[model samples]
Target: MAKEFTDEDDALLAELGVEVETKKEAARTPREERIIAGFEEIQRFVTEHGRPPQHGEDRDIFERLYSVRLDRLRAQPDCLALLQPFDHQGILADAILVPGPDEDISDEELLSQLGVDDIAQNDITELRHVRSTADKRAAEEIANRERCEDFDSFKPLFNAVQKDIDSGVRITRPIRKEAGFLKTDIRSGEFFILGGQVAYVAEVSDFFKAPNGESDARLRVIYSNGTESNLLLRSLQRALYKDETSRRVSEPSAGPLFTGENEDNDLASGTIYVLRSKSDNPIVTAHRDLIHKIGVTGGDVAKRIANAKLDPTFLLADVEVIATYKLFNICRTKLEKIIHRVFDPARLDIQIEDRFGNPVIPREWFLVPLFVINEAVEKIKDSTIIGYMYDPATSRLMRTKDWA
Candidate 1:
């Protein structure tokens, strides 16, 4: 407590030619002051950087720490409300990204990544023993997945999807943020590529209100690896959004693939495959760019080529998968006819022996440059491929009417 200065004390100070200074108000508690100081540091960083600090391995240590600190500040309600008056940067509501995988990061590095520079008893903002966001999410995904005992029943569906992908009956499209979807977009009996495994949305529960007042639902998703997850619909969506290579396996469509719409029943999927031969033949080695196997499949490309070593159709040797254009609503056999006819003029003249030494004729392998094949695929998607034919001399697609 401060002693009150009386009028006599003020008069005595005036007699000695000393002036009294007015004391400013110090209303905030020490804890609040510390919190505000820490937050001011973040605001300074934001002012300098024009954005909040981000969490990542390649980022500067201070920036990562600030990011973690900001996350903690926002997560704690008292801190957020108390500092709301001083939130000049408006960072409390920003959709900040969490840290990426830190398995390769050391304990010391992890601590820094999680933004706990001090473990002292007095540091209220220090985060100790808390998992990084990515680790927590990964653990959630793993925890949600369990042994799918009824996997036997779903095995045929996965096999059929692989077969469809191989045969060009169904195609996989990468899930991009711009192309991200909502809970309603996830349909029962549909498939997706999550973490490199095929996931089938076996069941979807009725929608219910989440604690945050948003709508959510439970999902029974089965994976190709014979595992299943009982995760919330939003959780699945978040996982898909985070995985850069995540894909949605489309319903097989025998119609035009890029019309930008499909009926729920249009279950036709297809792939436009571009393959290069591993044959030791002189012609193939000499004009590698001009030689490829363009075919359609509804299943796994690697599995399709697994028996290539003994098959004359693959030039009796193992082959490499160069490119594949996954598309929707195209009939596999119909697509097979379309591409084969497009490049029929450049069909390679090759023969080889099967494992049994039987003289064989190869099919699908063509004497066409790979670019021409890509162009052909684009044309097919737009439904204009029928009017174009491969021109061997010009190495370009020419209209049948324009052919001289």
Candidate 2:
């Protein structure tokens, strides 16, 4: 037989500081349902805006409204008996103790602000108690952060950069290898249909010339079949952007979600930009120098890009590799890590299961493993600053390191 505890038992247990009280089981009534509806509305308001009800008069009025529904519950023997096992005073004591929603955006006080009547729907006390305590904490954290102007000061720049990256054309790398046989001709250059030109292809080269007075950076594009096409620095840039956008859109959204970096570090995520220019065999690639100036420590790939002397198609592929791997690291390490240190530690355990039903940690954790790597990167200050020179005559991308 199930043991039944009296209201006095509930009071005694609560007085002893028990964490929870027992209540008799009974069928949920309409009054209970109404309470749930009202509570849900309150919850939604709080979640979206972040406002808590006032403690004194507002709370008292809310309880009064709640008791009207409880009156109905009291009429039912089962419901009343269920209540008998609850320490009502203790249960109701802190019922309205949830934190205020975002002080700025929370419209939680909207109803009161408009002088609306305190309407009673039902008693939602039980349902409200069922919500996880963690949810409240998380909500409070989100609200507080959202209210901090400094937290998202980069909204404009961030939005613009996101749009630029999102709007670019996607380019995918053609698989070159299959079971002992090369899938695509590595020697003859494939057509990059966008520029509508047949350029000679060449191996990825590293001997790019730096721009000088009256001279421009030259990006040599070589076709697979020993054919070649020369592109000015700007044209190469445009091609890189086109390829990045295309590849980004085509790739499925993997779970390593990207977020904006911190304010302290002016460096944000790296974006691939494509600038179009008409100069052929343009000398000096300034893109490398520009990133170098921006504190980019890993430019071996960029140097290799300069060396490849690739045609448009090959250059496009190389850009994808450089942007995805090298530049990606710049943002994740230099920017995101610094910002993540400010993340609330209490919310660190937050996670969601992937499609495979495996618990996956969020992108924030990726910084943890790269701490040493980032420290090493920051040490190479010379290679990471913006030290590029541009020449209008030849439309060149110039760098001192590549110059004599």
Candidate 3:
């Protein structure tokens, strides 16, 4: 039986501001739903970690993947607008927009952008099947490698890298394939700047085709801080590709430092002379090892020091040439500057009377051990003498915190 509606019932429904027609909730499109879900996952990550995820091999794999995904989402304006309501952490507010069209991206590149090599099948039935030999092989290849026991032998190499970094011979540039530091370019004795550290490709195994038909090799990577890793070449490539902060070290400057023949007529092949002052002063006699003047001379070292006793630069005292390392095709002035900068921390802070009876402070004298100076020069020869500071107490070269 149908019940009759009265004017009083209609008036009560109108008073409640209810519409007479039944309304259906709108459905979200698949793309919108995916964007929402992805953003929600990132928000959850930020909530749990108390910070946004960072990209690096050291970080959790899932965290690294999420970080890349978040970066992609931030680039899409539509995704940002959709996720604005859910972004309680304000992660989207400071997002950097990577300008590009979606059509320009390939499937492989898209996967790489997401910090992954491949996606698992969506079908549960396919996943339950017996694993193939190829799958097993791929799993074995991705496993962590054995530790490098001979890392001590590479310590000097690392020290040299730090020295190069400090000297501006090697500089950090944005990680890009055009920079010539790709997985295919990986070879033994190559150096790169990755993860804010100097990474050396000490050794590389022969390449073998993976299950996916991609070439892979095992790498012996040594870092500037005396740490070493035996990571897969592909893994290193992926890390470098995904990390925006990952930098490629510029090729060592091939200047007069390496050449035997002089390129410029003005530049001369010289020697870095380390002289011990033969001063009669009690202060100089008290510290023989601690007092030495480091300088570069283009002419004969003996002739240059023949009248050193009358010169204020030599502290008005005769000096004996303690050490001399032949420099091949270098500017004497520039080499002098480099040596002084390397030993700046241990510079001898002494005042002397010049020929004019005025107190003069010499700049080239440093209170450093002779062996350390030799080591520094060797590092310079190999082009790795930049970011190191001589620690007299440790009697070793240490990497500086900030090389820039």
Candidate 4:
């Protein structure tokens, strides 16, 4: 039933210099309405808080959910264009300029945003049972993880594991199907080389049965670079199976010192001997405080230095034994190489006379303090010496960018 236009309506149109006609409002699709509603809610939150919501668990659950939704909307160009007209806060333009992890929103947050409410008044036992089943399914899908507050404590383990890998002290083996890693074989303190990084199983929760009757456990996996994830055991197994380079680390290669052992292995052990030359040469006297010859001996240090005066390798002079470190289960040649490589930058650059009077430069002697040598040995025993380099300028072991 349309109302008839009278002479008053004609007079009003004529005054405005326009013709009289019926106007209709444009209709919006349900999807467009939903997008507009979601954006409007975000705008309202921004208006109330004076800033956009941020990610993390410390914030309210709803704010985190809104942050995730805003991230997703900002990622979609089509959604940005569609809601451009209603964006009075310049949200579309600002979102188009910023980038973030829009796709990392959790499933629980998404379900909660979809109006999934908690059941508070379940009077029937059958309904309660149905709700329990749904909750179990949600739990299985979500992986029941929380933030690892103690991740800093496990960072050194990953660093040590990486150094061991680099030094060939720890080797990776292919994760075989019969290795029992997927089932009940995963344990705490074990390490796996996955995704090209060292992954340590820092902690593991008790076993629980999932909906399918399979065993599942929560794991606090610490990765290289000090970050960690509290993922399910099955999830970790799936990641390892999918990754081609994933392997299980064998025994650590740095020796028993890393295991906090005070005793040496059963092999024929050697000693790292630091010798101070007893030469009266002018150059040796000038640099006596900074000069020292470092070597490894399989036998007694006294016997090794008995003929130092006749040997050109000892600078053709008798030497005094300053420091000797007993090392077991290690190759003497390799230990010598390690010490020389660590102190290579501070190698003494002086020509000394041999017994035949031919000037020769000894490469094993370095112009470094005795304390620095002791510190280097300690780092080698801990398998972390590779991460540090000898700084001649500062006379200390500084961390290297390559390893850090």
- Winner on lDDT between 1 and 4 is 1
On residues 279-316, what C-alpha lDDT tens digit does candidate 2 reach at each position?
Answer: 12122133322211111233353553453223331222
Span of 10 residues, lowest total lDDT, candidate 4: 122-131
Sort order, lDDT high to low: 1, 4, 3, 2
Question: Candidate 1 on 1-404: residue-level lDDT in tens?
Answer: 98888999999999999999988996988777867887898899889757787775434455666676676676667776888888866787655434443222222443654555665464534445544556555546533455799999999999999999888677776676663255556667888998788999999888899998988888999989888888888888888887788877767653255434556766647566788877788878997777898887788777888998777778877788889877565567877887888888888887777778788878888888777787776656544465467889898787665576
Candidate 2 or 4, higher TM-score? 4
Q: Looking at candidate 1, what is the lDDT of residue 39?
A: 84
lDDT (tens digit, per residue) of candidate 4 on 193-213: 775667788888888997889
- The C-alpha stretches of model 4 lying farther than 4 A from their native spots are 1-265, 402-404
- Model 4 residue 185 lDDT? 45
State TM-scores per candidate: 0.36, 0.17, 0.41, 0.43
Scored by lDDT, the top model is: 1
Candidate lDDT scores, in order, read: 0.73, 0.32, 0.69, 0.70
Steric clash pairs (candidate 4): 169-253
Highest TM-score model number: 4
